[model samples]
Target: MPELYERIAERFGELILNCPPDRWEDPSPCPGWTAWDVVAHVISNHRRAIAGLDGSGYSAPGRGEDLPRAWDAASEAIKAALRDPVKARTLLGEEFGSMPFEEFVRRMACADTLIHGWDLARATGQDEGLDSEAVAVATEILLPEDRDIRMPQAFGAKVPSAADADARTRLLNFLGRQV
Candidate 1:
């Protein structure tokens, strides 16, 4: 039984590892973000969350850096933090309030990674299918914040989805992805 963040991050990481080098600069579903930019955003978010857990200062992944290497290093640090009971349970700040670092990562970071995985896939011509379980969990967690999610964030305004669309499609639409 993997943690939610682990399961979601696994899919995102797989996409990263398989991304074509030539496609790294290709535009993604995320406006203004290339495929490489999507990966960097995920890595940066992971570093921010774990920074709160372990006091490891946050820094954006540099464009000149090897993003895959940086991503792997951050992933290893995050895994170590998650395994430590004290750090995992420690409170991390958010706009609303504070929750355990594990909860924050599982809820917010998990969803971000899952969605960005889709963006990366769309950009690089890889499979766009998402982990069904991750999509379900993300839908449940994100649906309630529909308005806030639309407000000039990484996500755009909520886009309409077909009534018959599947959970993953609905989730993507709710997060403002046109599917």
Candidate 2:
């Protein structure tokens, strides 16, 4: 799972690097957030994960017009944290109370990274489709039997999809995306 997280993080970084500067202000599936905002949010989340895993304090980076650089720094921090097996087993607090660091990386960090990678690609007109393995893992972790019960609060209502919708589409719908 750590290796998987690393791969997902690398893919997300690639997507961020490929995003055109002109499209940074374009709206994304996330309500009221621009493509740049999506990247910023992912970077922020990565910081939170790093803080939780390593007991380091998080200071939000200045994303503004320097989103790519900020993302690169955050990505490097997250990858570095994940490389330490001893630190990866540390118990985190709050929402991650006592959860192993590696588990948090798999369940929260990696999942968010992959999903937002898709969101960033879609927002920038770079929707070449999500990786199949990542989509499968996201679906399994994020969409449990009681997902509908919690969907409205976290993601709003599930958007309807065609009967033949692929796993990626289904995963998007589950995340309150219209794709």
Candidate 3:
């Protein structure tokens, strides 16, 4: 079975490789974030999570509330950090002490990569689809948490109870995003 973490990383790499720098500045689905801003946030997340994987409480540098520059710098930093052992880890975990590094990485990366991909696609008018494993992993990770119902920002949308529904849509809905 393909590891969801690796799949998520591959998707991130694909986005970086395929998305143009000009597209980075475009607006995203996120209410206030541009495509570049989302990229920055994703990069920062990878960097920080990798730090935690290394057993260091990695902290993301302030984006300074400046969207464009912050996004650009964060993208650059994430790419750069992947080359360092201290910043890159094959394994990952959460800072909130919620779950194992592997499990946390699966859910976090899936949510970030898939949702942000949607944001980027919406902004650039590109086709955005998540990997099947990512969708499945995200759905499985979310179903029992009840966090989706408790936290409006994280998970507020209603997930369909249909058994034959698409996993990606289910994950998105579970995360409170309208598909």
Q: Report the lDDT tens digits of candidate 2 across residue range 34-145.
A: 8888888788778888887767787665654477777788878766777777887877887675787778778765467887788888899885477788788878877774
lDDT per model vs. reference: 0.81, 0.77, 0.59
Pick by TM-score: 1 or 3, better one: 1
Q: Could you report the Cα RMSD, in angstroms, for every candidate shown?
A: 1.6, 2.2, 5.3
Q: Name the candidate, 1 or 3, with the larger lDDT value.
A: 1
Per-residue lDDT over 76-120 for candidate 3, one digit per residue giving the tens place of the 0 to 100 score: 544444545443444443343555444445556666766776667
Q: Write out the backbone clash pairs for model 1.
A: none
Per-residue lDDT over 34-123 for candidate 1, one digit per residue giving the tens place of the 0 to 100 score: 999899988988888877776668898888988878888887777778898898788877742498877777775547888998999999
Error of 1 at 170 (Å): 0.6
In model 2, where do residues sit more than 4 Å from their true spots? Answer: 63-65, 145-153
Query: Number of clashing pairs, model 3?
Result: 1
Error of 3 at 177 (Å): 3.0
Instruction: Point out the higher-scoring one by TM-score: 1 or 2.
Output: 1
**Highest lDDT among the candidates is held by which one?**
1
The per-residue C-alpha lDDT of model 1 at residue 141 equals 81
